[model samples]
Target: MPEGPSVRKFHRLVSPFVGQQVVKTGGSSKKLNPAGFQSLWLQDTQVHGKKLFLRFDPDEEIVSPGNNPLSEPLQKEWKEEAGHHQEVSEQSSRSPGGDDAVPSGGDGLRCLWGDTPAGGAERWLQVSFGLFGSIWGNEFSRAKKANKRGDWRDPVPRLVLHFGGGGFLAFYNCQMVWSSSSPVVRPTSDILSEKFHRGQALEALGREQPVCYTLLDQRYFSGLGNIIKNEALFRAGIHPLSPGSLLGLPRLKALVDHVVAFSAGWLRGKFQGRQQHTQIYQKEWCPAGHQVVKEALGPPGGFQRLTWWCPQCQPRLSLDEPEQVAPSSGARAPSTQSLALEGP
Candidate 1:
């Protein structure tokens, strides 16, 4: 699965193509199970998370339509701001600056820059592949859809691909909902922002709820996936089985900060604090001269996650550090006992 770094790179690569009208000269991969989308004209070109957003208007009614119900507020915000700009334009004529000072540029926000015909609201229609939807370029006939399983479809779209020439494709766990609309009101005060910055990890997840998997929780860190979780914990010297509540609020906050910083560095193909490359993730062996560890198990969090660590380089940790749970025995458990990892 792609991590935040890879997703950020995708956004950077595809965002420039927004608004370009294209057609599906070819079709999607046959290996991509449920081969629903193909040969459709694409419009509303946009990119969110890593998924590309383009609406396919069929000559006939579209079969599986995906929409972002959460983006309504953002749409409302944009409309209200446009209304405000129009109001300001009308009032400015009465002011001393008059028409000379008020100039309308060709685009909505660009009007303030100079005098030109203001372009009407630029509207775009979008088709999204929720968490696991993807599209490929015309050359990618054999390219696989990132998500074939899971409820990648919305309430309306279980199966059925937009048959057109042009659409967007992305990898596992992209954040398409956030790009659907813009927020109406800008931040008027710093209080809410400060509070959120101080306590962002525990906030309600936008999606992918009812999961204990630390890596999949967007609340803890936006754009993290399985790869990031496997590596980040190893780098931070924490066990994968550690619970969020047991990580302690301060350590959790530190971890969040570390993730954001490290993700940025990783995307740039660099390491977080150290100028050197990664310390241990996906490497041949432990850089610290210890045997690299690997485990494949159905973790308590849910997924059959992979974990890697070094016993000699990564010091043994006490269970009290993460508030270890006692095995299912009829004995009373201690509130603060120091438990040890079994020797290799």
Candidate 2:
């Protein structure tokens, strides 16, 4: 799945479409009838963690069916599919925050459209990318090479939006839903946000859980994923399985600082089109020439994720040992790169 940085990049890609009217819509999504979005103007775009939100408002100038270029058969299909759905306003009213608005049963196609709001009230489309999901602008994804079976074809976009300016956006392998409210609860929790609260992150880290599992918790560190978790832990010279309670305040502060620095640096590198070199993630050796260990570490009965660390560099800590921070050879002096880029 695309992490926060990657999702932020996607937001940038689709930002230009804001204020543009949807001239046409086409996609293979059985859940969402793309035709429902036709004639709507994109109001704004936002990113929270791994999710993208697009606000759309109805355009005043409605296009008549005679003038629309969409084929009649396709239009008929859209009407038929859209008929069975309820209004988004009705669904959202029953489930505030739009969290449970999507029905757990049926085809899972909880698409619902309502009458256009009277005073330019906006409807939102929330996008959540699956693993390997992505969005593209003015182009479709190219087809992969044929395998031994000698079969290959262009990938079908899960959703396509043709804009009035002749440009278009394509979504592949992503979940799109009509939402009534913004999903973000605490904006400051996002690592990339300008208001990211380091103290809050430290407080959350103080919980009695494996540092690895706690780091992955979205409630505390929005937009943080496995890559950031692994790299940040390595840079701080902390083992993944170390209990947060065992890690002292100083060490916890160091870990928090490293996470912010690394996340900002990684995002900066991405903006400059530079690839960040991994010091320990998926590596055979650490910078100090210590062999790296890879294991799936997590709380008992919880989902386990692969973690890589140098045993010599990031030794497992126990309550018996006096608190001592290890120096990571991979560590650098505290950076100001994070200050350079203001959060979105």
Among the numbered candidates, top lDDT falls to 2
C-alpha RMSD for every candidate: 18.9, 11.3
lDDT of 1 by residue, 1-344 (tens): 33434433333334333334333222222223222123223333333322234433222332333332213221222211000000001011010101111112332222111111123222222222333333232212222223345423322112233222244432221122111232221111111111223243444221222212645543333345555555555554545545555554544443444444444445434212233255556555765566677775344454465556555544443546543332111111211110110001
lDDT of each: 0.33, 0.67
Give lDDT tens digits, candidate 2, residues 1-344.
56676776677677767778999889887777788778888877777666677777785433222111112121122211100111111011110112311223333433544333335545667787766677888777765566356756666777899999899998887777765443333556677666667777888888777788888877678778778899889888888888888888988887877777777676555656667777888899988898889898766766677889988888888778627656666655456544432332
Off by over 4 Å in 2: 60-120, 144-150, 182-185, 339-344
lDDT of 1: 0.33
**What is model 1's C-alpha RMSD?**
18.9
- TM-score quality measure for candidate 1: 0.47
Error of 1 at 85 (Å): 44
Q: Could you tell me the TM-score of candidate 2?
A: 0.79
